[model samples]
Target: MNKVYHLSSCNTCQKILKELNLPASFETQDIKEEEITKEQLEEMEALAGSYEALFSRRARLYRERELNKKELSEADYKELILDHYTFLKRPVILNNDEIFIGNSKKTVAAAKAAVHG
Candidate 1:
């Protein structure tokens, strides 16, 4: 199954989900309703190169909560995400060993190619 971790209100998340159109094999975890496991978040962060990639710096949560990236430790990040899932980025798609952060044609194509290859 493909698990998507994202905020429901994010337009990018909606757009990617709409574009993918994979309802049967896909499951979406609303950031507000479902907390991503620390291990899962850590894996994605490593794959994307940083916790910043896993978290949504551009989201209203960041601005409204006044979350400064530089002030957070790795543990703090994990706790924050666990406690408040809305801080995560939109459309964080997890398919097998692959993870897609945000939606872009290049990212989609690359993920597909890698999976199919």
Candidate 2:
């Protein structure tokens, strides 16, 4: 299903969701409210190619935990994201089975074209 995984409390997420101009048929999951399921994450991983691609290295917890100091494998990235919602890159958009990760200008632009056009 086409969806957007986002944190409702994050302004960047809110702004992207708006900017994407998603249709009513496209579901939006607030990761903060309903945590991502293993199957769901795995599906994203399948589309995204790796768990690390979905992980947000910029999260406060990532720095607080000093994960950068350690070498993290794909499994580690998957486990970390499943453990905490913050690990997910904000506004992970899945459209027509094509995944758009993070809030970068290129990603948002791509998602906009995919969803609306």
Candidate 3:
């Protein structure tokens, strides 16, 4: 599965995607317009190891809800991501069986390598 789960409105996600220069075979999903399906989320979880790995603590809702202070479990993370798009870390790139999550310089760099490799 060569796919990307990203927020089109986010500059970081856009920049990283452009930098990756993915091929036509790659699929891009604008998470804002089309919410990620449970099957898609489950597939990502399978590659990523856990829902918490795919969750974004940086989301505004995370702070607004004071989730930072809470001891959230895997189920909580999964539910939160399903509840709100922002709860998901941006630019989740799936290069075949390998999954990459987030937009950090390191993560983006790795994703670029995977896509271009």
Candidate 4:
């Protein structure tokens, strides 16, 4: 199944759902409710090439909490992400062999290709 990791009320998540047009094959998991695991975060971090890329830098919590990527340790990152799932970016789609960070035309197309190709 195509698992879309996202926040429940995020407009970007909704937009991805709309663009996907395949509810049957996809499953949505709200990041807040889903509770991102350390293992999963590690996997995403490895693929993303940096922990910062996994975070939603634009969020108020990010600024309020002062989550500067340069200052965080691996363990610190895990705790922060665990404490606030919203700290991570929206619509982190995980499928068989691909990880998509956000909703965009390029990302959607790549996801489609990764799923169908």
Q: Largest TM-score belongs to which candidate? A: 2
Error of 4 at 22 (Å): 3.4
Each prediction's Cα lDDT score?
0.69, 0.94, 0.93, 0.74
TM-score per candidate, chains pooled: 0.70, 0.98, 0.97, 0.78
After superposition on all C-alphas, the RMSD of every candidate to the true structure, in Å, is 3.0, 0.6, 0.8, 2.5
Off by over 4 Å in 4: 68-70
Local accuracy of candidate 3 as per-residue lDDT tens digits, 1-117:
999999999989889888999999999999999999999999999999999999998899999999999999999999999999999998899999999999888998888888888
| lDDT (Cα, tens digit) per residue for candidate 2, span 15-112 | 99988889988999999999999999999999999999999999899989999899999999999999999999988898977999999999999999
Best by lDDT: 2
Report backbone clashes per prediction. 0, 0, 0, 0
Better of 1 and 3 by TM-score: 3
Better of 2 and 4 by lDDT: 2
lDDT ranking, best first: 2, 3, 4, 1
- Model 1: residue 103 alpha-carbon error in angstroms: 3.2
Tell me the TM-score of model 2: 0.98
Judge candidate 4 at residue 43 and give its lDDT: 78
Model 2 segments beyond 4 Å from truth?
Answer: none
